[model samples]
Target: MRFQRSAVLCLLALLAIPAAAISQTMDYDRLDARLTRLAADEDMVGLSVAVIEDGRIAFAKGYGVTEIGGEPVTDDTVFRWASLSKGVAATEIAILASQARLNITDTVGSFKTSLRLPGGGEQRATLEDVLSHRLGILPNAYDTRLEDGWDPAKIRESLKSLKPVCAIGECHTYQNVAYDSIAEVVEDVTESKYADAVQRSVFVPLGMATASIGRSGLQNSPSWARPYSKRGRTAGRPKEKIVNDNYYRIPAAGGVNGSIRDLALYARAHMGLVPDVLGETALDLLQTPRIYTRREQARMSSRYRGTVRDARYGLGWRIYKYGEAGNRVVGHRGAVEGYRSFILFDPDRDTGVVILWNSSSRQPNGIGFEVMDMAYGLPFHDWMELDTSQAAAGH
Candidate 1:
């Protein structure tokens, strides 16, 4: 029975690799034409993309205008990073852990005593639990509370009122408040605010000069993309608007704003191209898959269909295993009110892609997949056909 079970598992894994031809070299002209056409077909307001190769940016470009007939989007046009802040937060925590400032095993109650697991159980969730979305809290637990203007301290106190869907480390659920709790941990351990610590440890070290946290960061920036949303079914263009709320309440979870250029630098550091900025052990810990996520599995199963063998959640990334080669892809995507962004990389190849856009109607994941296909030499697919079909049907 044991041998049969093992064989079954192996066969299931083999079924996950898609049959496709591999290219010998990246076709830049084809890639550029596809992206430009995709942007137009999707009615994207403004899009900026950067490709990192061998620890440096190989290609960086922008498309469309920042506003209607206004300034053109550039590689430096800042966009709200949204949930991608979780990746930055995870890196910062890993740095602190490496420096012996904080231990991942420390319980949450140690820093914020008010937060107690339901039923008063002594097995409090640890920092690693929160970072990896294994805190057992229901997905997006107390996110509305934070959005409704409740302070983090009050939200922390309110955690006791909520119940976990499973025991700590038993399952995976995406979170914002639980992830943001690390900011407090950072402040307590380093005697500095989370934003300050992240800037000093990550942004400064990586030379991500334009990267900043929260509302003040966006406000201070002179060249930033304004938020936009689709107006109507056939609006043809997205309308510019302001996201008035301050994400500082949960800055560590979803408050970052930066450009594709800066994001490329961050991705370079993750690829082990910049050893002096980020240590190998730290990056490994951050990228190591901790808890398997059903949400990720379902998403990848639908996205890749026959291809993805497994999908799991790391500290702040979604890990996808694809192709016969079982190439490991680590990446994160983010969405705010009127913006969407995606950053993905193949660490083994030390190549990655960053996509930032101001409009919310169309996500950049398809573009990320295309870039991944190029980086890995996989045969390209018409990723935009489904979206185009949907739009046509709606019309």
Candidate 2:
């Protein structure tokens, strides 16, 4: 029985296509078919994906519906970027730094922001520290308050009272509410709203026409995927949820919405392909490995652990040493209450994949790795954990 089950799982992972053929080239047609199957297998509420190859969008598609029984999702369907907005904040800050408008090395206390570290730690924390999530306070310090109707300003003000867990720059602490402090920095330096600064610095210049900031940016979209949650009993589909504006309250941390196409262009810009918009110096600073992320390394699956030997955090990105070849892949994953997103790109090859879904399901996370593994000509490892899933379904 065990051997038979293993055989079935292998066939499912291969999806009737040989591993060698799958790795020979970045096959978009095959990828589109595979994504269709994967979305059905995962019962996703809505999904949109874009692949970047040779410095351009090679494949972009959508699967499922905007809502359970509503309109079908298309490439133009807008989905929330969630914490992926961090990369936007980092990129904008880098651009400002290059323009001599603000220096990342400037201390947090130097700016008119509400982030106050214990024992005057904010005096030592720099804009770079905030971007790299080295604030030294507890991880996600005021996220609960931020989610529970507390205004971002008030939550930031309350941070002054919390004791420091580690001194500034001593450890890599992941933050959302605290990380949004960059918004204040951008506002002070640009003398404008953070969203407007991002628009001027990023979206409009990159031709990301569908991209916009804040909750209304998502809700007002003519073709937007409604948020969905997989709660309650055994179900045929996930339940649609109200688009919570809590995360959007922290614009720099979790408030950006766009189509899959916009995300692909954003990734290309980071690869230094869109030089006129983002120069090499700013790109380097945004992606350079700054701190070792031991927590991330521990959380990765055993299969990926062998290939991704090191896990580190850059300005607003996650850097990894992918496969035995040790090629660098910059990527990030994000989750809000009812949405999930993942992006992975190889800067050297100028190849990457971005995925967005309007449900809480995490199944699509592995598709990005599958695409990367094929691009690198590596042997298949079923990064999607389909074997375990098959067992669960009694396949």
| Model 1 segments more than 4 A misplaced | 1-24, 120-123, 231-234, 386-388, 391-395
Residues 1-395, candidate 2: write the lDDT tens digits: 11122324322321223323434467667677777876675357789998776555667789998987799898889999998999999999999988988888999789988877777777889998999999888899878888789988888877878888888898999998889989998998889999999999899988788999988889888999998877741465677788888999899999999998889888877877766678878988999999999988987635465667589999999999988788999999999977999999998777799999998877788789888987888776666655576524623
TM-score of 2: 0.91
Candidate 2 — worst ten consecutive residues by lDDT sum? 1-10
Compared with the true structure, the alpha-carbon lDDT of candidate 1 equals 0.74
lDDT (C-alpha) at residue 175 in model 2? 93
Give all TM-scores, in the order shown: 0.88, 0.91
Alpha-carbon deviation at 65 in model 2, angstroms: 0.6
List the candidate 2 regions with Cα displacement exceeding 4 Å. 1-24, 301-303, 390-395
Give me the candidate number with maximum lDDT.
2
Q: Report per-prediction Cα RMSD to one decimal.
A: 8.6, 8.6
Per-residue error for 107 in candidate 1, Å, reads: 1.2
lDDT against true structure, model 2: 0.83
Give lDDT per model, in order: 0.74, 0.83
Point out the worst 10-residue segment of candidate 1 by lDDT: 13-22
